[model samples]
Target: MPHRIAAIQKLTATEPHPERVAMFAIAGDSASGKTTLTKGLVEAIGTHRISSFCTDDYHRYDRKERKNLPFTPLNPECNYLEIMEQHLQLLILGQPILKPKYHHADGTLGRPELFIPSEIVIVEGLFPLWSKLSRATFDVTAYLDPPETVRRAWKIARDTTKRGYTTEQVLSDLEQREPESEKYIRPQRAHADLVISFAPVEGRSSLSATILLRPTVPQPDLHDILTPATRDAAHIKLIRDQDGKPVDALHIHGHAPEAASRLVEEKLWEKIGLGGDIPASLGRISSTERSAPLAIAQLIILHHMIHC
Candidate 1:
């Protein structure tokens, strides 16, 4: 077992599953920026310290077989939920699992890959938080809910460019998956400790992210971190969430001057150093260039994972 998981077990000895591994669940719809966000966290924490998995791998049928099925892949019936739950339990107990691999490129099932438990196991996919049993396995949960228009654009770009789908085919597939997404996907948002939404700001072409820090988990003190950054320039705020409950709503401007984001980064690093040093490859998005707001978001998640 990884040292961090062992240390956590020693620290939480009295709790159930005292030897449980630290796990994070990132749930979202198709192309909802799950992989983009997960990549940053892995980089910040050091890839060697984290073992990642996707619940989509539990799909019972290959892509071609799914074409004849009545239910979509998003439906629970289409996945090996029982096996996933069993494997998750094993992972929490510091055991290894012979995991199945689904090749996205050719729509074929590859050989089972043996994955041993690590200090942190990141589970990201369409249904990581879909069940109560699966939900209990995570130490932290996040849901990505980008605007529909923005998500569609992202999905089209990804599917056409990487997944070998034409633009029209991708759009048609999305239309067919809408009902499943609404039924089995979006509802997972309520179970998240954080709901992240990235979209273009009004009157500005640059994209910005609004992170809703829910009360379900402990959050960093951005107020203390933003100390001298002045409210006018720094967009961070602690306000009521949509449910009328008090929550910290952090807004990171995409095109904001470097000094503005740097101020926040400095304070964040001051409070919690980036695993000793800032990672050189952190915060990369879909494009080659990195976004300051995305980097800050990654830092926020890394801080919580270490300090929570």
Candidate 2:
């Protein structure tokens, strides 16, 4: 929470720009839907207006090198934290950075590439809000806090299918990473303006989403959209957070009728005042599948990007 004070102080010390680039941070453990959530926002905002990249690229060791290391990639010591912070500051100032690349498929360090910031910048990965200075760079920040069982399943699925790991290997790596995840990764949730959790509803195939809207930043007023008529699809209520603070919690049911979810989406899109149809790219889980809860979550975040 000290970082929040630092963030406020830093913002007040700097001269505001009329065309200042808005920056968002999505922090979470490995395969906790950070990229998926960021992908939707980029598509909705347009690639020309937003630039996004993973902070995992700052890892100090490659896959081969990590085998002998004592700490996992989730540890702050395992990444170039200072460099990542510097690059983030530069990006917020509308400057370019020669960003490092980490190849997720093979776990190798790739060539450094030039990264230019656009009207909006989304930095997603494990350590975007790890430090006070780093936390000060974002206009909005969110943390994905999926259930451990669900996250483990997602990690296993992604690693086996795309990263060429066997089911057993992925499980083993997850067990090893759990301690670091608890120590370094989960703590960042405290720094986020929004904390998102996506979990399977009982007897449902798709995942329902729960978002905690913290008072750290201005959030969209959803009282008009979350009426009893839309309760089957989405609703909002005051709840006590982990820290015992009262916060607004928004729940989007995955099993809700398509029409019901669409109505909520329409209301949110109108609130965004973008003056166009909702982006077709919202809610896409894959080329073939989409989740209404995911779509609604993305729209709420998009609302923050435009209105907040």
Candidate 3:
């Protein structure tokens, strides 16, 4: 796939202080591991350098109200989108806002409270990059694009276990969410500076990842140097997936070797010029670029701060 260059590379300031509370957005569809990846990034960056958050806290209505909506999860109409954008702007400007809480397990909204500011705040959830008003607040934005099959399976498992949904119920909800996903969620892809995906090979648990940099950046072909052993262990393989289309027909899943993903990550750090191995709390992946979705987010904010 051919790469796209960002039309506007202007970096917007997120905080008054360059050293603290820069804003980032990780946008993706349901079950794309946005939360898991964000958590890993927070751990990798260390709690001291980065603070963590989920835009899931910004829901206007609790799960019950959401379930009753005509359009389900992807429905922009159902969420307090305007409110979310408003509060995000408030928080990004280094001001405090009354944050709401939603408890998925109970399908309820918890009490609201004021959250003090932090150095780096990660906003991860569906539609984190939904509107121009909200998208502008982000210095870096990444879109997650794991294969549909893997996403569906992950959704089924997650909803069933964590959210008290049966497989049948999950399917029904997914179907309802599909239309809005195409209309609202998918288009957000164009707004992202980077797009990354993780999928399994034909017969394995090895998760392959692909990262696409907006042509505006100086990122190189990161797939070349991935070693054979790395691919074998992580089960990651990279096929050119430029412009949302596959370049070659390669089997994904456990079929991919771990080296494929590692090679890309190795190239990631070498390019970023940011050093130091990944911290232990961030899972077994030791490379910084493997955490591209989040790290790129930081770069976005940093660029704006330096330039602003």
User: How many residue pairs clash in each candidate at the backbone level?
Assistant: 0, 0, 20
Which one wins on TM-score?
A: 2
Candidate 3 overall lDDT versus native: 0.63
lDDT by residue (89-173, candidate 3, tens digit) is 8877677778787777877878987875566677878878988789888767778878888899989999999989999998988
User: Model 3, residue 16: displacement in angstroms?
Assistant: 8.5
- RMSD, each candidate, Å? 5.7, 5.5, 9.1
Candidate 1 vs candidate 2, lDDT winner: 2
TM-score of 1: 0.89
Ten contiguous residues with the weakest lDDT in model 2: 12-21
lDDT (Cα, tens digit) per residue for candidate 1, span 123-215:
999988888998998888889889999999999989898888899998889999899999999999888888888888888876788888887
Distance (Å) between predicted and true CA of 194, model 2?
Answer: 0.7
C-alpha lDDT (0 to 100) for residue 244 of candidate 2:
95
The better candidate by lDDT, 1 or 3, is: 1
lDDT score at residue 247, model 3, on the 0-100 scale: 34
